[model samples]
Target: MDAGLLAWGRAVKRRGGKIPPLWYFTDAARLADPLPVIRRLPRGLCGVVFRHDTAPGRLALGRRIAALCRERRLYLVVAGDARLAATLHAGLHLRGGRRGVLRLPCLVTASVHNAVELARARRAGAMLLFISPVNATKSHAGAQVLGAAGWRRLARLAPRGHRAALGGIDGRSIRALGQGCAAAGAIEAFYFNV
Candidate 1:
């Protein structure tokens, strides 16, 4: 078990109502071996969000990831592909603008730019929401940035128990955010790597 998952597991044990921390790896190209990454995570980490556009032969890779996830007791979500989402038994994440048919009973998540989009994601059956670009991000150049204060304010209106702040998020920033969340008991789950 890695440090992140150990901390998260202890936190969950301490606070039964809180959700586990998550690590959203939006940079698919940078990921060399997804299985090792998943296995390194402790059994307690909530899940990993793998975002990639649907392509030929992608399902085979996704299925392999999903199978590894199951063995490790970690949830795997295929971001932005409803067909892959439906095929995978773990979770599904959709962007605010994408339109796709979702199969039932899998965990549903979405990215929201604002309250309106958040609402729309909820109506679409998203149980988790990733509100991104909370800070200026090199990966997503020219994207709108929502700082910590904005995240706090927006988090107030989220309907689901799970909401993660994305974009420009790094170790130092996450530490600070975790402290703030810890103080207010606002965020139960945190996703990151040390």
Candidate 2:
């Protein structure tokens, strides 16, 4: 496990919330396998969001990943696949283009980029949200970065730290960012350097 990821997991356990504070986003394009990192995480220490959308074998892969998550007691959210999520008894993570919540059996989360998207999530009854590009990210290089101050403002509009800080957050940036979220997540942060 990355020291930062471990520390983030410990932080989540320290907090008196049911939601874990650390997350690892699986991007097939960026990472070969997340299981190695997931294995290092203490059971129930973090959640995994499998986001290789449009992969031909997504359902099969989701089932396999879901089994692993169940074994480790990790919360698993299938991005853009409410049906699959529901079938596996896992949570659902709405894609960025989908602005509102859909009636589903499991927890509903949304990807929020700006204040406008935040407002939509607030109204749509999402249980969680991920506000992204908090800093420059390899996935979306040169994209708009939401500095700490801006992130704080956006977080306030959400469900009070029920959201997460995605993008470039790692150990150094996380310490600098402070307690703005119930959780912090990233692809690079967990897979490699920030």
Question: Which one wins on lDDT?
Answer: 2
**Total backbone collisions for each predicted model:** 4, 0
Model 1: lDDT of residue 176? 43
Question: What TM-score should be assigned to candidate 2?
Answer: 0.89
Model 2 / residue 142 / CA error / Å: 2.1
Q: For model 1, how does the per-residue alpha-carbon lDDT over 1-194 read when each residue is reduced to its tens digit? A: 33443554456446553344555453445553455656665575556776646444566767877887788877676777777677787677777724457665777767777888877887777766777667776557798777787876776777535566667654445454443232111111232341
Residues 103-141, model 2: lDDT tens digits: 676666777889888777666666677888788888888
Q: Which ten residues in a row have the lowest lDDT in candidate 1?
A: 182-191
Q: Pick the TM-score winner.
A: 2
Model 2: CA > 4 A from native: 97-102, 192-194
Q: What pairs collide in candidate 2?
A: none
- Give the range where candidate 2 is weakest over 10 consecutive residues by summed lDDT: 96-105
